[model samples]
Target: MTPSPILDLAGLTLEVNHLGRGVRFYSQVLGLELRRHDEAAGVAEFTVNPHQTLTLWQPITRQANDERLAPLRPRGASHLHYAWQIDPAQLEPSKALLDAHGLEWQEINLGTDDRPDPTLYFFDPFGHGLELRGVNRDDARQPHFPPTPVQRPAHALPVMGLREVALAFGDYAAMKERLPRAYGFAYAKEQEDRDFAQFTLGPQAEPDGNGTPRRWLYAWDPQVGLADMLGGDHALVRFYADVDAVAGQVDAAGLLSVRDEQGLAVRDPEGHVFEFVPA
Candidate 1:
């Protein structure tokens, strides 16, 4: 079956070591607007924009009272990374802002057979990687190449608008069923058993005759020796924004992490790992 066009990229929730410190870093350095806060509940939400919102909450605990809210030391490797897409034009200004803040960054051309433009990469205050790309409105309207004649995909949507991402979960099957029921993501196909399952987070239906169905989710295979293949351990988180504005803001924060062809790495205040890549 054809997949639907994604409704929108939602915010992410992560366990933090220090809720206040993490919130401060995300709000101040990332320029995310605080939308809501529940001190009594020890939960807060930040809006990246109208469509995306991030929430920071204390780790799950059984203790009663304020003591439960106390931040705890991170227990695992901070190898996760998240990528946010921004407008291409804002790249230099954003980079300058990061420089003003004393943050370091590295650049690379993300040219591919399908796309040959430059994509800038950097990190957040914590060390999550972010990437910015320039995608014109017209460019987003072009039909998916290796085109399907019967299906005329929506022309209004823009490319690089949070196309898709992978979310790591302990119970893959549970999430596989729960996400679609709660969020509207439809099961597309399994990339490789439970390790990685692809889902259609969008509403754009694949043409009836399309050769292979379009997939949204790419589940990770824990069994695979990913660390060994890369020579080190790594993790990922993915975020989406107006391709035009994200880079400049990231650069302005001056907390960008640098890296080689792979891209820079950064962590959230609580130490969750992530890497930024352009959509």
Candidate 2:
């Protein structure tokens, strides 16, 4: 029998203290298109990829007597880090653009083979670490690259949307063994060093529907501080799955999971939460 399919990474919701600041940074600095923003609802959504959405929501505290007025309060993850894919040709221009804006960025080699995929890591105005990975030339074992472009700042590098997200953990061995088996996601690539080990996850077959490739990176590092800086109780990565079969798949996998109104919630070895929502 064939296994249930985990179609695509449809959404990644991030909590932000200030919705306006988050919007400005992602729209201006990162060059993502602003899809919609509801001030009353306290949420702003952006088109990170073709069909992929990244939402920034601010917490609003309301008083009983003065119900009409609410103040912006701190909520969501503070220092969560995620990477956006950029054309390899734009690597130098991206560096130049960051320098022109007086933003400080650091470079690192994260490729498995000799030629490293050069990545530029920097923080947004709201303190969220954003990475621009030059993976145009890097070959994928299960290749799925689509040419999706967005209106960006003048002379700024165009973002191809989110390519990978890193989930840090204290325990590695157990998560490394179980996640792939449970989710039906294939191991695409991996790279490691003294500090941490990073493994990429993808579907066995090339994904369909607005099908841009995405990577689920499981990172293991014990001595690393600030691993939880960007994410907290509300920081979530939500995937769009076939609702009919997903629950059955989860049950068949025989993994311990909690089923709530939001769908199935599963935790990694070190307690990183992920939810599979109905598509």
What is the Cα-based TM-score of model 1? Answer: 0.50
lDDT of 1 by residue, 208-257 (tens): 11112222344443333221211012222333222223333335544333
Residue 48 lDDT in model 2? 75
TM-scores, all models, native as reference: 0.50, 0.71
Model 2, C-alpha of 69: deviation from truth (Å): 25
Off by over 4 Å in 1: 2-6, 63-80, 125-127, 141-164, 169-200, 205-218, 222-279
Best by TM-score: 2
The sequence of per-residue lDDT tens digits that candidate 2 reaches over residues 1-279 is 243345556556676777887887777777777888877777888877665778786767652211221121223444567777777778778898888767888876656456556677887776667777665433433333343556677845577767655555545566566655566544543444543444333345333212224444434444332323232332456565654455665576675566666666554334454567665
Worst 10 residues of 2 by lDDT: 63-72
TM-score between model 2 and native: 0.71
Candidate number achieving the greatest lDDT relative to the actual structure: 2
